[model samples]
Target: MTKSAIRIALCVALVAAAAIVPAQAASGGAVAARSRSVILKHIAFHPRTAHIRVGGTVTWRWRDGSIVHNVVGSGFRSPTKAMGTYTLRFRARGTYNYVCTIHPGMTGKVIVG
Candidate 1:
């Protein structure tokens, strides 16, 4: 075989091997939801309730709006930010509730089981 043909073959083989690596790596890991999120909009939390497995993380993201907000719960308190995010990982199984202190009616819940 010509030298250039051998080089081209090696390049093709390397590309094929690279493509299979990610698929193999993903398949080797356990398949389970490990995180969730809620969006804090104008006056409420979208999907005010979320369900996640124990050891999963919950992220609260602030949307673009005039009014600022926060999340207060059993042991989690996200600082008020205009357009920021807060994340917490639950280690136990239970119902966790949170609310925005600035707004009376804004509430959310996280159920871990």
Candidate 2:
């Protein structure tokens, strides 16, 4: 096949593959489930703490209206940009402590049992 035809065929294959792949699987399927959500308000985590089974997911929703908040764990830090929501999946059975970067005093914990 000619070079141009080969490129066209490759592009078509890529597009087809992309269309067939599920969005979640394409990203990463390790984290699955809508475990729970903790809203950020009054510069504190609404629930303060939560418990979930291992392999569960936790989503933090920033609800201070216009203020920016971040979910920072031991070594993981969510994007600093204003995010309406952020998610973290626990794969191990342990306690995880997280705090809001915008307000250090605002803290929360997650217990994965």
Candidate 3:
């Protein structure tokens, strides 16, 4: 095939593939509505960045390995604990940033879509 024809075929294939991908809706969309877990240990949150669909939940489990820590973020905060679990539900489509109030440089984010 000629180069120009090959390029046209590739572009058509790319557009076709893109059209097959699912699309996310806005406002009261059908999110996967699942849960994710993160391990809080070693002075950090394991898997610092989590991705979930809108209306999903994230659970932060405290592994008994250090001082007190908590998950603090916009309109959400878990109690400081040495050993326990905290869960937050993401109801909106946005990014939620959190950190441990007692520990510096301890930060994480949850991306909701």
Candidate 4:
């Protein structure tokens, strides 16, 4: 094939492949459809980011061996606790970023769609 023709073919293939992939996946991010749980350990949230449908709930479990932490996100907040669990139900489709108020650099996010 001619150079021009090869370039056109490659562009077409790229467009087609992008159409078949989710925008998040195309951007090199992992999204879980039924993600309902997260773990708080070593002053960090396991699975730092999660994805779920609108109105889905995500449960945060504490397992840092007596280390206190809290999940503070946009429009939602959890009381500080060293053990047990906290649950938050997302109502809108958007990205929710959170952090540990006491621990610097501890962060997480949730994508609701």
Please provide TM-scores, in order, for all candidate models, with all chains considered together: 0.70, 0.66, 0.71, 0.69
lDDT of 2: 0.81
Candidate achieving higher TM-score, 1 or 4? 1
Model 3 residue runs over 4 Å out of place are 1-31
lDDT of 1 by residue, 1-113 (tens): 99999999999999999998888668844335478989998789988999988888999888958689989997788898778899998989899999999899999999987
Badly placed stretches (over 4 Å) of model 1 are: 1-33
Best by TM-score, which number?
3
Best by lDDT: 4
**Candidate 4: tens digits of C-alpha lDDT, residues 65-103:** 989999997778999999999998887889999999999
Worst 10 residues of 3 by lDDT: 22-31
Between candidates 1 and 4, the lDDT winner: 4
lDDT of each model, Cα atoms only? 0.87, 0.81, 0.87, 0.88
Candidate 4 residue-wise lDDT at 113: 83
Q: Would you give me the overall lDDT of model 3?
A: 0.87
As a whole number from 0 to 100, the lDDT of residue 68 in candidate 2 is 81
RMSD of 1: 6.5
TM match of model 2 to true structure: 0.66
Global fold similarity of model 1 (TM-score): 0.70
Give candidate 3's root-mean-square deviation (CA, Å).
Answer: 11.1
Give the clashing residue pairs of candidate 1, or none.
Answer: none
